[model samples]
Target chain A: MLCYRAWVETRWRFLICLTVMLLPSVLYFHELGIFPMQHWTSDPHYAYGLLFGTHLPSIGIWTFAAVFLGLGGLLRERAVGTSTLTLTLPVSRAHVVGTRVGVGASETVALALAPWIVNSSISLFERTPFSRAQAGWCVLLLVGGGLVYFACAVLVSSVVEGEYTAAALMFALVYGIGYLADHVSGFSALNLYPLMSGTRYLDRNTNLFPGPMPWLGILASSSASALMLLAAVTITRRRDF
Target chain B: MIAAPAIQTSSLSKYYGRTSAVQNLDLVVEANRITGFLGRNGAGKSTTIKMLLGLIRPTGGDGTILGRQITNPELNRQARAHIAYVAEDKPLYRYLTVAQTVRFAAAFYRDWRCDVAGKLLREYELPLNRRVKALSKGMRTKLALLLALARKPELLILDEPTEGLDPVMIEHLMQTIVARAAEGTAVFFSSHQIAEVERVADQVCILDRGCLVLDRSLDSLRESFRRVDMVFPVDVVEREFQLPGVERIRANRRQMSVLTSANAEGVIERARAFNAVSLEVAPVGLRDVFLAMVNGLESAIGKEN
Candidate 1:
């Protein structure tokens, strides 16, 4: 019930942002007639594919959502003083942190999925010849990215006292990694920068031309996310509420 | 007499760097009694409550709630199952409505009394749909109290539960706490308001500067401590004035008030030798006892120095 209430309060803002995010992609597709020219030979089709492919990494976007959503969970409670309510309950600290993380992960998933569902529905009307396999991969990347971001956000919220500071740190880490990945080659592994680069991967579909599945990138993102969540739970448990 | 206290502390202490918040304090709260934990601000009342609830660790010594050792996680967890707490700040989720907040709290406790909670909300005239952030301070305190009371736990620890509440709300809270105590729930709460303590408390524990100054049943405290007001014929110099059983003495040229922990008659007899013109013995309440004990402790220290 706590999780559901939190989701209801936050879902509207999330959807609004998601809608605004899809606008640029929709306009780009319409202006270039990417839908009408399905043939690989046409510039629009290739351009559209490249655009979607470049944004395929999902790691960065998911990370940003993770952090953003995690902040909402941890910091909101602290802000409202509801954290005391949770602490006084006859439950363990682990249960409290776990429930919050689960709720956050679920919200991130819904947020990530909403965009894919909306884009897919719109594509049906536009007659865009986008690959279903690519769409599925995009969703996977989003989930993975969301998990990593959620973990990082939770970790930051646990350690930082104020909500704004936690949010700023999350933004810096997410975009900082993305900026580094764009300028430096080997550093692309750190590009799980939550917001800017995760969606950018889906925008360009860079995953299709990638060598070796970017296993190193996937591992780094997932490991960082898991480690952060673990740290958050541990810290919360030991804290004096 | 052999049964363990509902709440017990042995040499419990908390230190924040060089400063000690509560130092080597020992206290025991027996079952089926409302213990009024009284202290001035920064006197370690909140710190002591926090340590008792295991919200914070004690730097030294240990405590037990419902017979479980403070450090035993499993025991603490089990012991907490029988306890409920209302924080001093009355903090709740601001975004959630009152009903939603209650529902959220209900999820954690197995023995939560929803009927009681509903009754409290209605009786307290609290709006169910109002978000916690929108509620007034008194309303928030009521809701926090309602949540704690609805659990019907064996022990309830409240930290300054009535601090910001208006008179009527404070009275209602006292009634509710008294009612809860009647049902055999051990109530341990801290407040600076002496009148409230005098009204409902069965036992009173007075703390000053992280030390336990007075711990006695309210009735016994009143019975044992006496306030003797005396008017003297002449001025009494500091060192020359000595009275039997007088723990503390405050005197002016023509008037003197002596606080005697024992032998009030003996003190009065000694006061007669000083050519006292008038003498009156008044029954002491928690406030008088508190002032007397605190002042006496200070004076005793001063004399030693």
Candidate 2:
């Protein structure tokens, strides 16, 4: 039931993000080709890299939506005078926060998959070879890597009371990281832009595995997300309604 | 076996930095009775209620509801299954329709009564599909009440339940409280409305500046508290009348008025010893007792400053 309430509160934002990414992918594929047509079929690595780059914006958009989903806890409820009613229910604070986080995370994963679904549909209709493994890797990397921003949103919403302030702070942090990653080589691996470090194109001509995956960066991002989520839950548990 | 207290607190305090919101409030509300928690605005009435429900953590002390420790989150959640609370604002989800609101609340507990909910929905004339934000204040209040009453909770706590209610609604609300108590549900309500408190509350607890000033059964208050007015030919110092049982003493020239909460007879007998020309004793009403308790504290604080 709490999940239902969370969905009711967040479905519009999720749908908007999904539509924002889905329509653009379909349209981009439908329109006249900007790059050569042979690039898509002759070199699968270049095609995958191009696809990954085009869908990078979707990660940022999903992060925005996830932030909004995380902003519906006691502070927001108190503004509407419903916090008392909510807290009085026979449910623990952990359950309420857990349900909201779970719902928001689920929506985030689904949003991450929207572009892949659109690309796969286009590939099938056009009779072009689509790598299931590459598509699966894209979805996995986007979700796993993009969770850092989602967790940042949850942590900000847990602490900050005003909606605009929390959102603004989250955007600043995300954009600030983007700016730092572009300027500094050391932070490039941590850059969530370009979607999964823009790998799958180490050699543009061939799709062969010579270098190992960026396991350290992936591990760092996943751990950061978990830490931020745990912080949010701890803060919420200690708070008064 | 004697029934246990529906609610009990020991030194329950909430402090906001240097200021105290509620201070060492030791209170007991017995089972199967309507107890009115009376206080002036900002007298910690709402704070105490919030603490009892575990909506907020206490800064210093703790309480229990239905024998479950309120400070423990798990225990409080367990206790809440049997508690129904209506906040002062009568809050409901404005985005949900009235019917959906009812359905949402009913899904939480195993003891929800659809029959009572249906009866209240009809009597209130609440449009099932009408959004909560579109409803009038009175209708919103009724919807909140319906949600609470339909559960038939073991304890019902309302804060300022009749604050903006009309006379008819107030009367109906009072009757509902009495009916709930008759069904063996302990009702604890906080209000500034003394008349309603006197009419419905079996016991009254008055708080002032985070401290309890009075806690007694209404019948005992009526029997003990008295207003004794006296006229003296010669002027008498205020300290002369500060004997036992004297709560507040007001003096103007040769006129002296005294309010006493206990041993009224003894206080009056001493007044005669001062060679009073005339003396009058009147029974203390709840309003007068409440005013004296609150005003007396104000004057004391005023003198300190």
Best prediction by DockQ: 2
> CAPRI verdict on model 2?
medium
lDDT tens digits, residue span B1-305, model 1: 56569999999998889899898899999998999999878989988887877777888999889999876656787888889999888877777788888888888788799899888888889999999889988888888888888888999999898887888888888988999899989999888788988899999998888889778898877776777777877887644445555667776667767777668887778778877899888776677677666656334223322
Error of 1 at B163 (Å): 3.6
Give the alpha carbon lDDT tens digit for every residue of B1-305 in model 2: 99999999999999999999899999999999999999999999999999988888999988899999999999999999999999999999888889889999999988899998999899878999999999999899989988998988999999988866678878888999999999999999998889999999999999999999899999999998888888888998888888787888877678777888877787678778888898988887788888879886234323322
lDDT: which candidate is best? 2
Q: Each candidate: fraction of true contacts kept?
A: 0.57, 0.86
lDDT of 2 by residue, A1-241 (tens): 8888788778888888778768657655754166566756776666555555555566666666666555566666776688888889999888988898899899888887778887877777765556666666667677776788788888888898764777778778777888889998799865775545346534445442244555666678889989998998899888887
Cα RMSD of all models vs. native, in order, equals 4.7, 3.4
Compute DockQ for each candidate against the true complex: 0.47, 0.80
lDDT of 1 at B12: 94
- Chain A, model 1: TM: 0.73
